[model samples]
Target: MSGLLALLDDVAGIAKMAAASVDDVVGQAAKAGAKAAGAVIDDAAVTPKYVHGFEARRELPIVWRIARGSIFNKLVILLPVAMLLSVFAPWMIPPLLMLGGGYLCFEGAEKIWHKLSPGGQGHGGGDVIPEDAAHLEEEKVQGAIKTDFILSAEIMTIALAALPESGLWFKAAALGLVGLGITVLVYGSVALIVKADDVGLHMAAAGRLRATRALGRAIVRGMPGFMTGLTWVGTAAMLWVGGSIILHGLAELGWHAPEEMIHHAAEAVAHLAPADLRGAVGWAVKAVIDGALGLMLGFVLIPLATKVISPAIRAVTGRAAKGH
Candidate 1:
């Protein structure tokens, strides 16, 4: 009887520890996911365009394919790579994170510049024979998956950087959770955005009440504007997150001046705000400053990326620029 009781107590203790670990993983994953918000938002924003020109019936299917690929990118590929980095090259994480941050800043700034410049926009897809719908759909899915791989790499790296120091297995679990959760959040949102017009149409055409029909019509009309707004939000988030990461990286690398300056300035702004809103005000001020810094860095990088990097890649690969 005594032996059995001891065994049961041991089992209960183990269970309690396991439960606590699970909670820790969840908490860490949530925090890490939040840190990667810039990449996540951009991923969701970019995905919808891949389904454009597809048949309505094919939209959901295409989304599913891309979502599956995103899962593979995050879990099968990026997660293991992140784990390896944590184990073998932990010191590299900060620099790699800064590189990713710089890339995000460049992308966000380029988008803003394009929008502001006259005739800067170009439609996706170069001239080609009209391939079969099935073939074209597959091509788009492949292209989207490739794009997701880059974004997923960024997201994973950012998440990895954000995690507190921990055991290898614990870090892996947290990163895995972050990967899976973010994939679902981004692609699920994409699916909804893609199918919204269909839902609106059904409501507009079939709603029994006039008000319901009007609401549906409004939804249909609002989706385009909503998508455009989302793009802007994503750009702003990229700049803010990217700039902050770079600033933090510099501090980590023994240059604390920029970070300290930003912190003091934010505190000053926060203190001027109403007591209840101080924290929010401070965060917003910091974000704006970071975004401005990111924009400046991005502008500096644009010519280098376009002239030097693109040409070098093209020369090595003997292929045209992957502009998208």
Candidate 2:
């Protein structure tokens, strides 16, 4: 009886420890998810375009399919690779993150360039015809997955960096939780955003109340602006996160010029503002500086990506131009 009672006590202790570990993982995963907010927002923002030319009925379905692919990308593909990296070659992470950061910078910069130079959308097969409706949907979904792979890699790396120092199992648990949580948050929001117009249309047509119909009309009108705002926000986030990563990377590697300059520059700018507004001013200045730096780095990288990397990728993958 005493031995059985001791066994029960041990089991209870294990359960307690397991519960504590679960709590810790959840908390750490939240922190990790927050760290990857830029990639998360960009993921959601960029996905809608994939469904743009499709039928309204097809939009949510395409998003659902893409979201599924994104989950697979994160969990089945990236998760194992991330775990292996952590186990064996953890030192390689910063360099890999820098690479992803550079890509983000390039993307953000390229977008700005495209906006400035109307004809510059010449890269990335913007000229190609959609083969058919089904083919087009497949093409867009595939493109979304490819893009998700890059952004997911960035998010996973950021999440891994933000994770609390722990055992391999704990780290893996936290990362997996972060991955799952972020995918749900991102794609779920995408689903809602894509469906908002339909919801508004239904309400506008079918609602019993005049005020409800008015609100629905407002929603339909407001959605376009909201989507545009989301795009700009996503772009800004890409720059902020990408630049911060690069700056942090340089600081890690002992090149503190960017970091110190931004810090003092923001502080100097903040001093010009009233006392209560100083903190907000400082943050705005710092973000602006970081984003500007990111844009500059991105601009530099875009040509290399287009002229050099694209050709090499084509040679290696042996894939022809993607018909958009």
* Tens digit per residue, CA lDDT, model 2, 1-324: 999999999999999999998999999999988988778888888887787766777888898898899889989999899899988998888888888888888888887788779686444434224457888778889999999999999999999977876899898889989888988888899989888998999899999999999988999999989987997788888888889889988888889987998999999999999999999999999988888889989989988999999999987676554441
Question: How close is each model in CA RMSD to the real structure?
Answer: 3.1, 4.0
Task: Estimate the TM-score of every prediction.
Answer: 0.95, 0.88
Give Cα-based local distance difference scores for all models. Answer: 0.92, 0.87
- List the lowest-lDDT window of 10 residues for candidate 1: 122-131
Best by lDDT: 1
> Which ranges in model 1 have alpha carbons more than 4 Å from their true place?
121-131, 319-324
lDDT of 1 by residue, 74-138 (tens): 88999899999999999999999999999999999999999888987756664334567888888
**TM-score computed on alpha carbons, candidate 1:** 0.95
Residue runs of model 2 more than 4 Å from their true location after superposition:
1-12, 119-131, 268-280, 319-324
